[model samples]
Target: MKLQLRYLLVFAFLCFFSVSFAQRKKEIPQTTRLLFVLDASGSMNSAWEGDTRINIARQILSDMIDSIANVPYVEVAMRVYGHQYNFKQKNCQDSKLEVAFGSRNNNQIRTMLDGLQPKGTTPIAYSLEQATKDFPNDGKDTRNVIVMITDGIEACDGDPCAISRGLQQKGIFLKPFIVGMGIEPKYAKGFECMGRFFNAKSSRQFKGFLQEVVKQTLGKTTVTVELLDERNQPREANVHMAFIDQATDKARYNIVHFRDKGGKTDELDIDAIPTYDLIVYTTPPVLKKNVEIIGGRHNVIKVATPQGQLNIVQNGSLDYSTGHSAIVQKQGNHEILVNQQVNEPHNYLIGNYRVEVLTRPTTVFENVRVNQGKTTTLNVKRPGVVTILNKLSGYGSIYVVKSDGSEDWVMNLPEKGIPRTNFALQPGRYRFVFRSSEANDSSYSKSVFFNLSEGGAFTLDILRL
Candidate 1:
């Protein structure tokens, strides 16, 4: 009995240990992998302050690696270019990944940097292209970062800006953190689109820039999408929102705004970036393009999408079908606002619109204003349908002439085989002019005056012309 008890206790302890280990593994977040794209071209040997640019970069990078030694779930790698070939050898493809990304790889990186010597041409663009393959193609949870330390621009004929932009568009890597070692001010403009350029003039400045870059790459920032009502207040919540990359127009983050216990909008932790396009899926959809988000700061985007209810009434009946009514915007170009049929009242963005009702004569209410948080009720008068029974054996079209002698083309009455064509006309006094398709003279056509006032169907018999 004693031996059996002791075996039972051991089994219980092993089961607890297994469960604890699995829970701990599940708690660990995804790794942040950073790649250092070092430039070892001949220009790196030039003196910057009291030491060569390469030497300064090597020392600062070593120290930076040491500083992050205690950070959890972090991996680092290094790639060097122009260090293996001579300057006159024309070796533009001299870049190589010296150290692959892994934890506790600092000693390998430092040893490799110590042995590198600046010799060949600077292939900044080629090195960056190669670095894209060094990262593991794991799930999207892993954050891939690149820190480019270079003193000169691309010596090869490759376009680094285009390469960087392409990489970002492909979602392979984030915006690179470029530490320009003693780069001239006039030449700095050339690298504006490559990445976030940090012009380091001295050793201290270089070290500080690297530290900041590491902190930013390893950290996350908060972004809040404030859905504003008509009064520009943050009273709206539970709306779907998307953060789109401006370079690619690809959605990077999507979330629904819900107030927390503190009655404030919930903030999301997104990878640090310079700007994003905030898109809100409101009634009519709202877009706030090119919103800038600075690192280590809380960003709040106040999106004004005040909407009003549009209730359309046809004649004396309420018709919610969107097919019968259309609200179009009156702006630079006419844009249709609401066209879908709604059995109930629907919301629309507050603006001026032209409400068109598909009545007999197609009633149009121009300059209709939709106010915020209020219902804009539109009542349309139905027009009378007029059917023209043609007895003449000819192809012709009918035109309606108004009191001012202005003519509007109605419908074409086909050849003698077709008996009639229908026309929806509003309450008005007008004259109908019938012109034969083969006739060129206006006097050869027939004309008649007709007045329509009631909202019902009527037939006009054309016994002769």
Candidate 2:
């Protein structure tokens, strides 16, 4: 009888500790609200990539809807312009809303997209005005986004540029990302300017334009953690962490970095560690033994006592692989946070507190080349301090100070290595320079002269320094 009583007590203690470390997430859900203004005017009847503009628009809208449908707390609304284009009648009223503001199921959205037929004059400006009115402005904290995909210029009254400006002035809520789908080169500028107007042009190039917008909507943040290594400098590669659902103990971390479909270092694939919205990545100390972990929801994971501590690093993506292993060395109630929203007091409590240590991965990049008014591709063999001609780190923008120090060359690399941009720049001796928001003087890369005189197209790979 005493043995059974002890077992029950042990089980109760474990349960208490496990429940304490878990956190609760607030239900104040937010969404990256999106609006798609698709042009279905007669001009859209033209062919693009062997498909009609109407069909292409349908495909793009459908694909985007499918991609974002699974993400919780996201709502997408689409509006079709110039659906009833009437060149002979020249009626601006032909441009009207095909779908109102509301939640759209995939099939419903797809159906609405299919129903669009190109038949009216292109009142692209009128369509913009209509979209401007469609979005609700209840003064909520939602992030609104509007994406206008058109293949022609304004076909009715009101200047499209002025209309764009007006929308900005109004609380249309989100910024606009205009896409020129096979439109004339002359008009592409006007549409591109719309993105600039909203300060949404993260990339000056064309390839990753749309994809970058999507990535930005996914949300990004800087992870900062200070740890006492008792050794030399702390390295991120030695640390690991993962996203956990506050409701469950399921977790997954970045085990490897690969070139994503967009071909940029800004992406990481999160494998399913468990079928839970949140999971604890590290094996915490055994003092909180026999803890039950629920899967498939936002989870809360925390320590049981204040004595237990977790180590973290900053300035890079956190990795939760084996580095997040934890242990229990003390007893008492403790708290930890699973996937709590940023800056929220969403800590979970735990009994018999254990520490789950997480560390970030460190990367070293070398042999970076920076050229002026040139498109150069720098290949970092592995993730590390990538320098261009011994200048900037990682990828994107690389600044170079000339040997004579007479001028500065600000070179931009395509976020992805697109074939058109690969081997696109002329070869010359150059030095590397780093540009970052932080005021870290030592982070700058050393100056090196590199000549791209290989003549024929050749791949220059960057190795670890």
Candidate 3:
């Protein structure tokens, strides 16, 4: 009897251990994976006001990483392009990944981010494909994100948006936020269109685009669901229940039972609902059921960190820098941009972040180009200014190199930023090419040639492309 009792105790201990292990597995933190797709194509080598844009990008990214160092349970990953040897001979076909996905150890990520310089053809599609592999959809509860920063249109084969959509269709909600650096205002439309489609535009208001992205991943909310009938009426009048993460793509459902409307309620698991349809009063005489529901409003309560706090937004970036609070008691799924700002260096952590993200900038430009006589009458088309702007402040200066290889003009101006310059010469067989001061700087543009009429008036139209 003694031996048997000992054996029984051992068996019970084993069962307890198994149960504990299973519970621990269930409690693992839901992960958010960020993939940094830094452009290393040839066009990123230019300098901005003598400062290399690549260097600036490195500093900014480093600062960002340092800012988020204190955020709990957050991990980051990075990948770079244009590191191919003999990239020119390869027709920019060699846009390869130098760093695979990995955790952002300050030292490791810093080294990788700092070592990047622009060069090579823009293989936007290929880089995205490589990054997708970093986020495996094999039943892992991880939110995947792709932050692609580029300054030019794609030079490699395959469409970036199509590739991103394909990944999304595969159960991977890949939100791609594009950062256009050192690109002309005329070409900003395509980037804006991409942001609109993905619902992830980095508002140009305060350079808080990337910061807003970080806040979005860190922010959480609790939603209360009160199921209503097809008549657009509330079934459980004034009976409140809470569902966590109510307004986000990832929602946690918890049901509460209030004995009566406006009365004390017992918090219960959502699964405790009598039926999947969540209908009560299921019995005899009345023969009533909260049957077949549709077309009802959902109230989404978005809560920011530091608990029960609020933020005020100006433009797309946050104006409330320090301790500020606000509540959003909005209903329905809002596809709106939220911005958060952290002004002080020490307060740049998760709870201290002030979230903000602005709407697309107001741009004024029609698709028209007129080439006039000795004085080429160029119309200034943009909401803010006629100067060139660098949406993505990385890579390097953008050099407008003439196809003849005679002289090149490099630009790194902000909004209404750089002054326009005119060229005096006999315009014949001239093609415009762009260059960057990065590792992938050798990729040239398709040469377009036009003849200059010796005396008669000749017109040439240059697309934003």
lDDT, residue 252, candidate 2: 30
Candidate closest to the true structure, highest lDDT:
1
Best by TM-score: 1
TM-scores for candidates 1 onward, in order? 0.74, 0.40, 0.43
At residue 449, what lDDT does model 3 achieve?
38
> Model 3 misses residue 40 by how many Å?
1.6
Q: How close is candidate 2 to the true structure, as a TM-score?
A: 0.40
lDDT of 3 by residue, 1-465 (tens): 999999999999999999999999889676666677777666667665466556656776677777765565565677777655434754545555455544556567788777665667777777777776666555756767667766676677667767765665564544466766666766666555333212222223213655655554455422233333233333322222333221132323433334345542232323110111222221100111222111122222211111112323222123222332221111232332122222221111011221222211111122212111111121211111112222322222333335566644323323232233222222233333333233254663223333332222233222232
Assess candidate 2 and give its lDDT. 0.47
* lDDT (Cα, 0-100) at 427 in candidate 2: 32
Better of 2 and 3 by TM-score: 3
Q: Give the TM-score of candidate 3.
A: 0.43
User: Tens digits of per-residue lDDT for model 2 on 102-215?
Assistant: 554677788888777777777767777777667677665565677777777777766777676566555454336676666666666666545431222212232244555555
Write model 1 residue lDDT over 346-445, tens digit each, in one string. 6667887676665433556777788877898876665666778875665555555666888776556566634776666666665666666456776777
Residue 349 C-alpha lDDT in model 1: 73
Local lDDT at 322 for model 2: 29
lDDT of 3 at 263: 40
- In candidate 1 the C-alpha lDDT for residue 385 amounts to 68
Cα lDDT for residue 297, candidate 3? 25
- How many clashes (backbone atoms < 3 Å, residues ≥3 apart in a chain or on different chains) does model 1 have? 3
